[model samples]
Target: MNKQKQLSEVTELWKTNKKQYVKKSSFSAYTLLIENHVLPTFGKAFHVEETDVQDFVFRKLESGLSHKTIKDILIVLKMILKFGAKNKWFEYTPFDIQFPTEREKHSLEVLTKSDQKKIMNHIQEHFTFRNLGVYICLSAGMRIGEVCALTWEDVDTDRGVISVSRTIQRIYVIENGIRKTELILDTPKTKNSIREIPISKDLLRLLKPFKKIVNPSFFVLTNDARPTEPRTYRSYYKNLMKELHMPDLKFHGLRHSFATRCIESNCDYKTVSVLLGHSNISTTLNLYVHPNMEQKKKAIEQMFKALR
Candidate 1:
């Protein structure tokens, strides 16, 4: 019988073979999860049974990880085990492991029309360092992290467009028993996510002034010339929403607001999906394609006129 290899060896094989498909940051996350969590728990097992996986998941969830997080961990585990199975390190495939699918019931939270205007009004006049960032999120439909991580090279004022090639996320990294925050620059979450989104002429005019005002290499949105962490900005967003007397919403709610407005303006779901960098049109439809009562009524009237 062939000798079994350590977990690290298996991961290295995946990384080497999967380079074109896997982004560096994703590979890094998988590596970190395996080394810090999965490997330490199952390293010596040489072959993890399906029952072992079920127990690990139960313990992880009980330790307070959210369902989404546990699901992500499971994704890594499955990838590794399947790879191991192909390599013949295990006696049999570990296909019995499964994740419980719970319906995601939290309704998609979006900003009310009045709140959208009020927030825009507040930022337009206030014109702080974050003004450009806020404008991009509201007008360009860029996520807060994507806008914060953008650079001068990505912005083409002449073309009235912004190219989204990369994004930054803050993650917790544990080293030698201590945890610390690290900034990871990753490829956009999906292939379709890599796209060029058109910007309004008015938005371009607003940004032109900031070009000369802020450092070019640094992000368009930052006080100290670094990627602005989303967590800290969410608190600021909460305060702004409170001052506007708006319904409480997270920073991401702005992106949702953008998609909502586009649909209301008769933009097709596919167009909105492309603008938002969704992996596919189906995701956009699933998340934001519900027509409001007024729109439904209008649609029916238009249909009658067409039939007549």
Candidate 2:
């Protein structure tokens, strides 16, 4: 029998291969997961057993890791294992892991329409480039990274659209046993995320005059060549919320509020999905399509009418 190889050995090979194929941001994420979670647990193992993985799952849960995060860890682990097996250095074993059922339905936080309006009204009266970023997110449903990456060139007044091609984020990188961070401007999360969304007339009016005068290459948020990273922008947003005497909602709630408003306005589910640049309609339906009490009552009435 051939001698088995250590998992750490397989991981190094896999990461080298993975780095060539994936974005720098993606490679960074995989490396962080592997080093922080996978390597310590299974670096020396020649083969991973199903029971060992199950126990690892339970331990991660006890340590307060979410099921989704643990699942991501397993995905990276399996890739390393598969790579090792293909080289005939380790045995391949498929493990079917189960998670405890979650009974409580977690609701997404969204801003109330009045609160959303308050912020918008304030921005319109007291306009600043930084505050406009929040308006754009609320109006167009762009993610924080996407908003941070936006430049004047991406906004087209003639077409009344915002072209979302890239996102910016700071990622951890490890090189030659030295760890550091890098801020990268890369393509958006998925191909679907690289899309064009129409701007609302209100926002379009605000942007049109500035589009002609501002440097096309300058970032929209800072009106400068240098872009603000998401962390700094998030801090600005938090302070803005406090100044407005609003509830302390996470920045993502602005996106949720936009999608929720679309649903409330009776927009078609697929249109809402496209506007939000969701990879699938199901994602939009899942997050923002829960029927209200009035809709539920109407649904029941229609069903009874058919029966009668």
Indicate the worst ten consecutive residues by lDDT in candidate 1. 90-99
Once model 2 is optimally superposed onto the true structure by TM-score, how far is the C-alpha of residue 187 displaced, in angstroms?
0.8
TM-score of each: 0.78, 0.94
Candidate 2's error at 294, in angstroms? 6.7
Error of 2 at 188 (Å): 0.8
Candidate 2 wrongly placed segments (more than 4 Å): 292-308
What are the candidates' C-alpha RMSDs?
4.1, 2.2
Per-residue lDDT over 267-299 for candidate 1, one digit per residue giving the tens place of the 0 to 100 score:
978899999999888989988888766688999
Candidate 2: pairs in clash = none
lDDT string, candidate 2, 71-150, tens digits: 99999999988988988888879999989997768787888889999999999999999999999999999999999999
Q: Give the number of the best model, judged by lDDT.
A: 2
Q: How close is candidate 2 to the true structure, as a TM-score?
A: 0.94
Candidate 1 ranges with C-alpha deviation above 4 Å:
5-21, 35-44, 54-67, 94-104, 171-180, 212-215, 223-225, 292-308
